[model samples]
Target: MPDKDRSQRVSDAVHHRRWLILTILLFSLFVVVLDNSILNVALKTIAAPPPTGIGASQSELEWAINSYTLVFAGLLFTAGLVGDRVGRKGTLLCGMVVFGLGSLLSAFSGSPGQLIGFRTVMGLGGAFVMPATLAIIMNVFERAEQPKALGIWSGAVGLAIAVGPITGGLLLEHFWWGSVFLVNVPIVITAVIAMVLVVPDSRDPHPGRLDPLGVLLSMGGLVLLVYGIIKGGQLASFGSPLVWATMLGGLLVLGLFVRHELRVENPALDMRYFLDPRFSAAICAVGLAFFALMGVTFFMVFYLQSVLGHSPLQAGLLLLPLAAAQMFFSPRARLVVDRLGTRVVCGGGLFLVGLTFLGFLSLDTASDPWLLCLLFFCQGVAMAHVMPPATVCIMSNLPRSKAGSGAAVNNIFRQVGGAMGVAILGSLLSTSYRHGIEGHLRVVPRSQRDTAGESVTATLAVAQRLGPAGRALVQPAKDAFVHAMHVTAVGAGLAAFLGAAVVLAFLPGRGRGPCADDDRATPGSPPATGRDEPDL
Candidate 1:
């Protein structure tokens, strides 16, 4: 067979088997999304008896979550490019194996530090998994087929986020908290087996040579940037030199990394994609969407656990309303995006999420838990409308050749937003908590008041020492924390509204039609033009 003839045959094969390709792609995506949220519900379970030699406040509690996202966000672009250069199948298999190994390690961790180390390994695997899946979907499907496939992809993602917390909660109840990590082991092993059987090997036909320096610069820049977000609140003062250096240095490095890519013959990251407005807009929307999500997750969980004093299981159950809303409305979301346009659906969704947060201000720490579910349910409805459509628009608009990189870019911003959302929200919650605690403590006797003013970690310890009085003080401190969380909720909702403003202004309407570069996903086609980055 001649080379040209064989290429044509392969193209035909890809189009014919696109659905199978999409299934494989979404399953891998399921794993990546699942682990991100699964552990949040476990925060309390792990903190309860507290792992051997682990203290909730002193331990690397946040690090366990932050590390995975940090690594995932930082290395994602390089991984995408690597997949395009190497075989996507090989890249994916490598990622799965590492992910499985990390899950196994997390299950057996004897200390908080150790668990975090392994989670970082999982994040490394995530960097590979996320882009490869999206790239393959692009590689296999035609442009017209992308929205339907992406809708399905988004649905799987919705299911993952919805199921993760519930699954984690079940794991904690049936076994130890470690079981939460153990749950990934079987899922990963199964995915690996399926990959060997189902996934096709694909790569960039005219792949450029790898740029080692560009890779390092981009990855290092992301690492530093995320590191700053994770540690910013812990800094002695908001304007500390160390925090400034890391954050500033990270941005500088990323800027240099972009410049390096433009200069290099075969850049690991192709900066030219940014030149395309459609692609840029898509990436921007994804970032903002996740930013809203991360903020909600960060504050809502504490609102349930710290404010309302719900058990981990109880809190997990409350989220079911949000999950249910997504499940019920997902199909509708797809239809709306296809008919009304991506911007209208996404912008409207953000408005709802903002309203949910705004409405939460009506409650105090003593507010009814059932009413809180109404807010959670609104969030669910909001997410169901936005997520799938936004993903479809972004993935569809990007060129097929750069699909992996495009998805990776989107995922990276989402992770960064997730990290920052948590950091910023956490800081706000903590600051407000201190203020609320101080005001409440003033009404109590000196001996009783000091415990309320103590650090959250210290109060937990003093409760053990104080006997009945300590338990009495617990309610007061918790009340303070709850009031603080209420304030945080109002602020987070408003921030989401701000993110929506960006979408309303720049995002294109659906029925208006895709731009010229829209057909850019055509296989064996040249580069695309005129797409915006959907952003954070």
Candidate 2:
């Protein structure tokens, strides 16, 4: 009776502090995810000359962005495994320190290469921090409260993504371009201190020996795949031998990695988890949702700035509706899932996202800003609905022991999807833009025509150089860009719709319990943990 009372008191203490712990975790998560998009608004400043900018070349600027993403995505799986083997709280703390130091170094970087190197360090830190947040949440929250905790966590991430540009724009307005990276330092420091006080150490109880071969295969495959994707986007063609070779090689290596893991005594990732329908369907849903969102946002920044004549600050403010809707609806999404189940909520959310993408097709230079804001709000609503439910589904399906690994794989899908979407959509945009304007530029000199056909920014620059004679090129260039935006929007919409279809077909219906369909197990399936059916 005395021991029972002691246990009850301990439980009460933990439960009392849960929300505080969650706040710290969410803040940590915010910084890591913010890094992914914060640099978007700063890239131009970083490439400009003067005390305010670093004068990086265009290619260097691209590398500055891609380097962080490539390293972050490639190292995520390994980070997750490491966190699971080590303690998640310790990993989170170390990650925060590294990330803060990296940001400080980035602010002091003399050249673009130095800044890029610092960003890579930041990415390495983020890989550790991201998975640890999810894993900690999975460990701390009770099953009944998991959805609510996850909802808040997901909302925080969505909010960070939405607000990242605004934060960058505001910083750049008053400070040097390096301030964007520097802003992370104070926030990370605060979170690191809070985490140490409130968060508990958690790790896999029976983490087996590391799989070096699996590690090599997975890391190499991801790095090569991302490199191929980025290279393909830059060249605007998958026809390049280097692109195909790298992508194919990455795929082959990943296949071998999976095979080796299945045969090994202690695999890095348990392949059996993929056999579960809920896990598989949820992964697909999250991947497609991010792919569309990332692709749209990538081009939308350019469109608002280059075509609509909005300042970076104005563009950032314009995106507020999207962010607002995401934050407002995400915490409520789990409720919708409770009533409708993952199948309906996830499928319907993606369907709505697709519709919103299609709505962009109707936009023109003269279109109302309010109208665009409404569309963005709708897109955000769809995203809010999709992500929380998908996240809950994925996390709930995995046993507590492998939550870190599961979270890593879930994020891997998102990162890969974002990378692919950006590459493919950017290629489509370039192709359509070039085809539209190349014919119109034939009357100009070959060099000037080639310059004008390169990009809308180039066309505008070339037009300025031509003075009044370039007036003929201005409207045509904008028109070509609008045309490309339409084509890309349609393609993005199609991908989302197809993903929704896959979710509907593969995901079990509403009446099925969480583990009800586990009877059709693989040869080496582990016993079910009897997780609740998400209050549906």
Candidate 3:
């Protein structure tokens, strides 16, 4: 057969397998994202002492989550660059292997410090996995189908959000705390095998040289920043000189990193991307949305388990409505955007999210479970609208060859925003709880006051040790936590509202669709006919 005929046949084969390829990519993405939320249900268990738990303090638990997020966010740009330089498929395979190993290590961790370290390793692998999946989708799907594909991809994240806690709950019910991490192994193995068999390899033919300094600066800046935030939370005050020093230093380094990127001939991340209003607004919206969502989620788990007296499995089950809304609406968000425009849809969604956050203000120790579920579902719907449209805007603006970079920007904002949410909102929760419960701790010994004031769990633990006397501390601790949650919710709600304002002001209106032609083009790109060719 002629070479032209053979090339046509290969193209047809690839075209037919695109959806299959997407399924495999989603599987890879699922496990990476699953780790982000799976720990929520287990945080209480992990905080327990001895063989049952790791005895991690609230600050340590925050670190456990943020450790993964910081590393993931910090390495994302470099990982995207790696995916573009090496094959995305290879990057994905290697990332999954590394993630699997990290998960295995994390399962057997004997201490909170060790768990934090192992989670960081998992983040490194996750950094590689996240961008590669989106980049691969960009290459596999045509522009017309990109929105649909992205919607499905976003929904996969929602699915992970749903599955993670429930899976963790189920495992924890029967198995040890390590079982949460251990569960990742089989999923990783299955995804790896499927990807090896079906996923096509793609890379930038003329990739830019690696920027080691930029990578170092980014990682250093993020770690310092997050550490400072966590430190402030641990101390329950931002007045510490150490907190200010680290935070300021981090900002300085990040500023310098931006300046360096602008001047460098071959930059790690092109600073010019922010010049696009759509891209910048969309990225910010995503960040802000996750900031609210993750922060609220961090506290809600505690509310369900500690305050409301629900089991881990019960808490996970309660979140079903939220996941259901996300899975149902994420894929259909594009349709809404097409009808109402990006600005309107995203802004409206964010406003709804803000409302949902404020809804938490109504909950107390005896609040109706149905009301809680309604709020979760509404928040999930809001998230569905926000993420897909914003993501589509960000990715569609970039050239397909730079999909890795585009994906990195999208995810970096998400992870960083989430990390900040956990750190900042968690600090607020801690500070508020301590203030409310401090005076009541007069009954407790001075030596135990600090630990008892640290968290609801600590206070309750102290109460439990006091036997019948401890019963008095329980109601006060619950009341203090509720107050703290309300305070955090107000902050998170304000953040969401601010995001709504930003997107409404800046994101593109309905005048042009997301996939409008830009200047960048592949050298030998085929013309887009606004439709996929029929499969062979």
Candidate 4:
């Protein structure tokens, strides 16, 4: 056969195999995202002293979580650049190997410090895996089918969220806390095997010289910023000099990094991509949406476990409605977007998210479990609408060669926004709880009063030791947390409302579908545009 005929046949074969490749990609993504939430249920277990646990103190436990966040968020941009330079498939496979090794080491860690170090290694691998998955999808699928493909990809994240906690709970019930980390090994092996057999390799055909300075600056800035955010949330206060100074320093360094990118001959990421309204607005919307979602989730866990008297397993099970709604709606969100437009779909979804947050005001200790489930379902539906459409906007605006960079930007906003939410909203929750419980603390000794008022968990522990006398403190602690959660809900709701307003103002209305103007563009070239329709 002629060369042209042979090439056409190969293209058809690749197209046919795309869905199988997507399945493999989802498996890779699942393990990476699963580690993030799975560790939550294991924190209490890890805090116990002796062979059963790590004997990590509260501060040490906080560090164990923060270490992962700090590394993952810090390295995401550089990792994306690496994926674009090297082959995405190779980067993904290498990342999974590193991740599996880290998990294996973490499972057998002897000290809190060792666990923290191992978690950081896992974060490094995760940074590479996350962006490469999306980048590969962009390369594999045509523009016309990108939205549907991305929707399925987004749905997998929701599935991971539900599975993470439940899986952790089940493992802890039967085995050691390290089982949470150990579980990742088999999943990684399966994904790696599948990937090796089916996934195609792709990279930037015109990748320029390396930008070492850009890498250093971005890593330093993100590390300092995320560390400060984690510290503020842990302390439940940003008033400390350590928090303010570190965050400010991060901002300053990031400003310098941006300026350098603008002037550099071969930038790691093109600074000009932010000039596109669709790209900028969509990323901002993602950030704001995550801010509200993460903040609400942070408090909701405490409400379920501490206030509602649910076991970790029961709490995980109760969250099923939320995940179920996401899995049901995320893949279908594009169909809604096709009718109503990206702007309307995403903005309305955010508005609904705000309403659900406000709905928390109706709940108390006596509220029915069914009511809670209903609220969670509603919130999940809302988020399903926002994430998929907004992601489509961000990715569609970029050329295929820049998909890794675009994915990195999307994740950066998510990480930073979630950090801010947990810090600022958490501070509000802590302050309000302390104020509400201060009056009741007089009954306890002065030394224990401060510790008791620190958190509902501390108060419950204190109350349990005092037996009948301590029983008096239980009702007050629960009431205070419920009230504090109400206050935090209002703050989170406002963030969602702000996100809705942003998309409505800046995102385009009904017009051409995403990537319509650029569907015919060849690799390594800028996207072509001539359509009179709206940008997104």
All candidates' lDDT scores? Answer: 0.72, 0.82, 0.84, 0.84
Candidate achieving the largest TM-score: 4
Superposed by TM-score, candidate 1 places the C-alpha of residue 86 at a distance from the truth, in angstroms, of: 0.4
Worst 10 residues of 3 by lDDT: 527-536
* Per-residue error (Å), model 4, residue 255: 0.5
> Candidate 1 residues 302-414, lDDT tens each?
66666576766777787788777876776567677767787788889888888887787777767787897887788888877776666766666556556677678877887
Pitting candidate 1 against candidate 3, the one with the higher TM-score is: 3
TM-score of each: 0.88, 0.93, 0.93, 0.94
Error of 1 at 113 (Å): 2.1
What is the Cα-based lDDT of residue 409 in candidate 1?
Answer: 80
Query: Can you write out model 4's per-residue Cα lDDT over 1-536, one digit (the tens) per residue?
Result: 24444332225555678899899999989998888778877887897887889799767887887788888899998888888888788889999999999999999999999999999999889889999999888777766577888888888887787668888889999999999999999999999999888888777766789889998898899889988898898888898999999999999889889999888988887877777777788998999988998888878877888899887787788778888888889989999998889889999999999999999999997778999999999998998999988988888777666678778888889888887887788888999999999999877888898889888877887898888889999999999999999999999999999999999988877885552245434323455222111101
Task: Please give, for residues 64-169, the per-residue lDDT of candidate 3 as tens digits.
Answer: 8878877788788788877877778888899999999999999999999999999999988998999999988877776556778888898889878877888889
For each of the candidates, give the backbone clash count. Answer: 24, 0, 0, 0
What's model 4's overall lDDT? Answer: 0.84
Q: What TM-score would you give candidate 1 relative to the actual structure? A: 0.88
State candidate 4's TM-score.
0.94
